[model samples]
Target chain A: MIQAEHLTKRYGFTTAIQDVSFEVRKGEILGFLGPNGAGKTTTMRILAGFFPATEGRAIVAGFDVFEKPLEVKKRVGYMPEHPPLYEEMSVDAYLRFVATIKGVDRDKIDSRLGDVKARCGLAEEGSRLIKHLSKGYKQRVGLAQALIHEPEVLILDEPTIGLDPKQIIEVRELIRGLAGDHTVILSTHILPEVSMTCERVIIINNGKIVVMDTPENLTSQLSGGERIELDIVGPVENLPALLREIPQVKNVSLGEPQNARQPVLVETEGSADVRHLIARKVIESGLDLYRLSTQTMTLEEIFVKLTTEEETQEEETE
Target chain B: MRNYLAIVTKELRTLFVSPIAYVVLAVFFAITGYFFYIILGNVIEFVMQRAFQSQQFGAAPPPFDAPAAVIRGFFGILSTILLFLIPMITMGIFAEEKKRGTIELLFTSPLTHLQLILGKFTALILFLLVMLVPTIVNSILLYLLSEPAPRLVTMLVGYLGAFLLGGALLAVGVFISSLTENQIVAAVLTFGTFLILWVIDATAGTGSTITNETIRYLSILNHYEDFTKGVLDSQHVIFYLSFIFLGLFLTSVSLDSGKWRG
Candidate 1:
């Protein structure tokens, strides 16, 4: 539903986004993961037709964002970083105004207003002025405005930034329910949000996209092999040699001692089930197993790895 | 067209919702009312003096037209008061939106820049019309109280001139609002620009004849004089229309530049 080709934006001599390109498929919830100043908002604004890209083009819902911005704007609902709202207006009045300007049919405005207010949990606050609402409620009103027209694509920038944990979960549920009917592209620095809500993830750093894949793939691809962590109480010098004898075991390394027990990492081949064999071997070796846990790299670790890897690469080239 | 009307309504609601609009209205009417009282007082005093001289020395006094003397003079000062008050009405039209980050909503909607500008301009124009309601009431009372009825055509033409002049000034204010995010800055800059236009005629005699003529033509008060005289010349109409167009065109250009820079 959305395509961006070599999209670059420059503010005078400074480039906000350089050669940024990504595609979002229909009915897919794509999480845009990036650190601060990573050009995520800039990219979203360009795609939403808020402004023209300096050096490239973006197409949303089969219309050019630069040439046919009105068409693109009609199909996309964009909630900027700060929910663009008129504070003096009541919630009902504000949503009605947004629906009208968004080109919702005159006959459908009342129904659309009802649907969005109920969906965003704002039905009760309809008569209250927006400035009187709390931050979380104001944010919901922002979401309500974005969802009023039921656009095909939703470009939300940090939709759950300042909410409480319960509100966050509620918003996540709401976003999750939007899949299969709406193409959502949400950008945030929160890693677990991507892992929990998105089908695909794009990691960007310093105005460049560093990695793009599913969360699981990103974890495994960065780890290079499946890893199992082991904590045992025994002489660790011969553990590597003993664990290497197993057919499925590839490599074993012992970590530093803590509380009279040493941690060991066991690397296994692809999709191998060797935990049973390793537990049995620990019994035969006359060693006390304090803890044995199988693990893989997490999305946070992958994010740190990819972004730091880019920095080191630049340092090396320089 | 529906989008334009939607924006216009939305803006008008915003204007009425804020207390600043009430404060501006109060200040506007207070000034115009005080000026009306003083001018009418002076006219009545001048008439008494003329009547006394005619009775004592057997000299005839000049003819007095209450509607022309009071109404035209009232509107004349109304323009000067409008010069100060119109900026307050327009300073927040675009500047407040930019400061609050609501301009994003307008820009991302399926509305064109021209539509946005016209919608906002129309809302301010409507507010100006609403503000003139009290003066209209006062004019009606004067018409009812007159022994010899006032000339309706001259009064209508005079009010038309006031409306067009206020429209031109409002367009200028909108353009100034688009250039800044601070309302105070917008208001001050608008007032400053109008002040310069107001004083341009003062320098007419200091320069060469051709330069003096050009300066006199550029002065806002110079073109507005014919309207107060009940003269509906097309040249004056065209001048005010062109002034309004120039201001709106600059505002639209500023919006385009903002989009490109953003």
Candidate 2:
């Protein structure tokens, strides 16, 4: 439903986003993951028709964003980073106004209002003033405002930034539930949000797209090899050599000794299950195994590595 | 058109719900009411003196149009008061939206820039009309009680001038409001601009040179004077309309430029 081709935006000397290209299929939940100032918001703004890209083009809901902005705007609902709201107006009045501008049918406005309010968990808070609501409720009202028109595409920039743990879960669930009928492109610096909610993740950094793939693939591809962390309590001077003897064991390194227990990190090639062989080899030796667990690189480590690695490469080139 | 009405309704709701609207309305009514009372008192006293003088000398009192004099004085003061009050009404029209980040919602919506500008302009005009209600009623009451009523056409024309002048100033206020995210700054800038326009003719020397004539013609008050004198000069009407269009056109250009800068 959305296609951005080499879209770049520059504010005088600084480029907010440069040569960014991505496509989001109909009814797909695409997550844009980046640290702050990483052009996630800039890319989303371009797709939503908030501003024309300084170079290139965006096609949203089958309408060119620059040439047919109004038509694209009619089909795309945008929730900005701050949840653009009028604090003085009640929630219902605000949503109705948005619905009207989004070209929602006049006859169906009341029903659409009811539907969006319920969907965003804002049914009871509809009568309350927006400023009077809690932060979580205000966020929900923002979501409700975006959903009121039932647009084909939803562009949300940091949809769950300032919510409690439970509110965050509820919002993630709400976004996840929108996958089949609504194409969503939500940006966030939160790692788990992208893994939990998006079907495809786009990691952007410093005005460039580093990678775009499924969450599971991103972890596995960046990690290079499977890792097993072991805690052994016996004499561990020979543990590295002993673990390396197992077939397909690529390398073994010992961690610092703490309270007479030694932590060992084992690297194995490919996706093979070598834990049982390593356990048998440890038992044959005199070492007593206190803990044996395989660890995949978490999304947090992958994000840091991906974003930081690019900076070092740029520094080296400079 | 639907989008325009939607924006108009939304803006009106925003205006009415905030304390600023009520404060402006109350303050405007109080100040204008006080002036009306004072002007009426002066007019009544002057007419009574004329009557008494005629009775003493047995000569017809100098033709004193009490209602006309009252309207002239009331409208003159009303326009000046509007010069200060209009900035308050329009200062937040776009500034608050930019400050609160709602301008993103507006710019991204399906509505055109002109629709948004016109909607806001219409809302302020409607509120200005509401603000003029008591003044209109006051004049009608004066007409009923006075021995010689004010000329109805002239009175209507003066009110039109007030409306047009308010609208022209409001258009300017809207343009200034769009240039900044600070409401106070917008108000100050709008007031300063209107103040210059109000007294621009004062800069003209006592000469019929083309430069002097242009300066005198540029003063907003110079054109408004014709309406108060019961003359609906098309030139004045065209000038106000063109001024209003220029302000709105500049506002449109400003909005478009923002998109480019962003």
Candidate 3:
């Protein structure tokens, strides 16, 4: 439902976003992953039509954001980095104001308010002044305002920045439940949030799109080392020699000694798990394998490598 | 029109929800009450002196030199008060929004810049009306107490003129508010600007004695004079309308510029 082409934002001598392009299909939860000053917020702002892009254009729900901003604005709900709330007003009052300004139907406002409050777990606190609420509640109120209009697309920036772990899970569950109904593009630096909440991940660094794919795909693509650790009851010294014969095992290192047991980290070049073969080989070699543990590269490692501040190393290697 | 109503509601709700509106109203009434006290005291003195002169000099000139002098006096007094009052009410209209980051919500909404400006300007007018209530009470009491009786129509016209003048100044205030996110800067600059306009009006008179008028016409007080004399000149009407329009236009332009840089 959203398409950005060669989007760029420049301020004087610095470029906030540069030649970034991507597409989010309908009903897909696209997690925008990046660090601070990584053009994530800038890109979201352009998509929401709050600012015109310095170059190219963005189309949301079939309307060009720059050429027809009002139409785009009417169809997209955006929660900025801050909640964009008036501290003096109650949560209900603030949501009502947003609904009015967003051109939601007069008759549907009450129903929409109820729906949004329930969805964001804010049904009981609508009458309280926003300034008086805790930070987590404040962030939820911001989300509720964005959802009150019932727009087709939701653009949330760092939606869970200041919440406790339980609150974070609740908000994540709320976000996860939003999929299949509306197109969502949430930008956050938190890694597991994307892995848990998104169907697709777009990694951005230095104002450029590094890669776009499913989280599983990106992890595997960058998971260059998946090791299997074995615990045996036999000798530890002869363990490395027998495992070297396996074709899939590229290199192995005896893990630094730890409490009660010795560990090993393995790097593999093949797609198959070598744990079973290594285990059998150890039994045949008469070595005790006390522990067999596998470590696979998660989406976090992939994201860090993709969006790391060390841009040149990854760019040249990729 | 729906956009306008929505923004108006938003502005009114914001204006009433905070203590600042009440504080501003109270401050305005207090200052205006004090100014009224001094002016009433002086009016008593002027009338007494006129009475004494009549007894001594036989029908000495009536106190009013020309209606225009009173017009100038009323405008001068109101303009000075507005110079202080406009910024307090207006500095937060756009500046506070920018500072608190609520302007993002506003800009991203379906409402346009014109709607936002008009809504804020209307809210300011409502606050000004609230300030006018006590002034009306004062007018009624003064009418009952004065012997020769103040000119009811003249006073009514002068008050209406003051209202319009405040509207124009608040529009200017709104424009100034849009230029910065610092309320203090907005208020200070707004005061400085209106003070300069008042000084210009006092110094720059209708040009040559013959077929007069130069840059004195640019003064806000110059344009506001017709209303104080109970004269609703079409030219003055046009002038205030243009001034209001210019302020609003610039306010809209500033908001639009902010969108680009966001």
Candidate 4:
């Protein structure tokens, strides 16, 4: 439902996002993963029509964000990093106001208000003053406002940033529930949120999309191949050659020796199963093998590696 | 149209529910009420002294014309009071939204920039009218107690002048508020700009003939005085209308520039 092409945004001499392109299909939740100052918010803001892109084009729900912003805005609901709340207003009042401005029809407003309030777990707190509520409740109100109009596309920036763990889970569940009906583009630095809640992930770093794929694919595909961690009680000086002698074992490196147990990290080619061979090799060599386990790359590891590597590459280029 | 009304309704709701707005309104009423009582009392004392002197000389007293002397004078003071009070009412209209990041909500909505600006401007005007309730009540009291009541047409015209002048200043305040996220900065800038407008006539009086004429023409006070005199000249109406349009236009341009910048 959303397509951004060569989306570049610059603030005077500083480029916030440059040539960042991505797409979100209908009824899909796309997670934008990046560290702080990674131009995630800038990209979302451009799509929301809060500001125009310095260059490039964005189309949302078949409307050009720049040329037909009002049409695009009608179809998209955006919640910024900070909940745009009027603290003095009651929850019901704030939602009602948002519903009205979002063009919720006069007759449908009541039902929509009830629906969003219920969906966001805000039914009981409808009459409470927003300033009196905790931060989690305030976030629910923000989500409620975004959903009040039953928008076709929702762009939420760090929807769970300040919430407690329970509230975060609740918000994630709420977002996951919205997948089949709404096209969602959620941005955050949090990794598990992407894995748990999003179907597709777009990892943006330094104003560019460094990687885009399913969370599982991002981890497996980006990290090269299989890895195995071996903790052995033996003299580790000649272990690299012995481990490399196995056919599929691509490389081997020893970690620190502590209390006579040495840690060995073994790399293998794509999806290879070399555990049995390594076990037999340790036995034949008379080395005591204390611990050996296949280690798959986590999303966090891939994320840190990709983002940090991107920074290093940029530094080298500079 | 519905979007505009929605925005206006929301703005009014925010303004009325805030304790600070009421505090400012109460303080305004107290100050204006005191001035009203003092002005009425002085006009009454002057009328009585004239009656006494004329009776001793076996002649009629000069026509008091309370509408001209008192009601018009009251409106004149009302305009000046609104000079300070309008900024208080408008300082937070855009600045607060900017500070709280609610401008994102408005900008991303389906509403047009013109609709948003007009919606907010209309809300502030309505709030200014609400603020004038006590003054209206004071006028009603003068209407009831005076022997020869204030002229209905004069009272209406003078109140119109006050409203138009207040509307123009509020528009200027809205534009100033849009310039910054700091309400205090917005208020101070609005006040400074208004002070210059108020004193422009004084500056005009000392300048050369052509300069004086041009400055007086540009001065808001010059156009407003005619309305206070019960003269319904279309020129003053046009001036206030154009001033309001200019302010709103500038505000819209300022807002639309957000798309061009960050």
Candidate closest to the true structure, highest lDDT: 2
Deviation in Å, model 2, residue B116 alpha carbon:
1.2
lDDT of 4 by residue, A210-297 (tens): 7789988766654555678989997777788888898888879888888888989887776567799998888788899999987653
Candidate 2 is graded, for docking, as medium
TM-score of chain A of 3: 0.73
Q: Report the CAPRI category for model 4.
A: medium
lDDT of 1 by residue, B184-243 (tens): 999999999999898899978975789898888888888887777777788888888999
Candidate 4 chain B — worst ten consecutive residues by lDDT sum?
B63-72
In model 4 chain A, the worst 10-residue window by lDDT is A294-303
> Which ranges of candidate 4 are over 4 A from the true structure?
A221-302, A305-318, B51-67, B205-209
Candidate 1's residue-wise lDDT over A1-318, tens digit each?
A: 999999999989888889988899999999998877888999999999988899888989999999999998898899988999999899999999999999999899999999998999998999999999999999999999888889999999999877877888999999999989999999987777888999999987678777789988766655544578999998878778888888878779888899998999897775668888888788789898888887644434546764675466446645
Q: Report residue A48 deviation for candidate 3 (angstroms).
A: 0.4
Cα error, candidate 4, residue A238 (Å): 36
Give per-candidate clash totals.
Answer: 0, 0, 16, 0
Candidate 4 overall Cα lDDT vs. reference?
Answer: 0.87
**Candidate 2: tens digits of C-alpha lDDT, residues B1-262:** 9999999998898899888889999998998889989999998999899899899999998787788889888888899999989999899999999999999999889999989999999999899998987777788888788777788988898899998999999999999999999999999999999999999999999989999999998999999997887789999999999999999999999999888776
Using DockQ as the measure, name the better of candidate 3 and candidate 4: 4
What fraction of native interface contacts is shared by candidate 1?
0.84
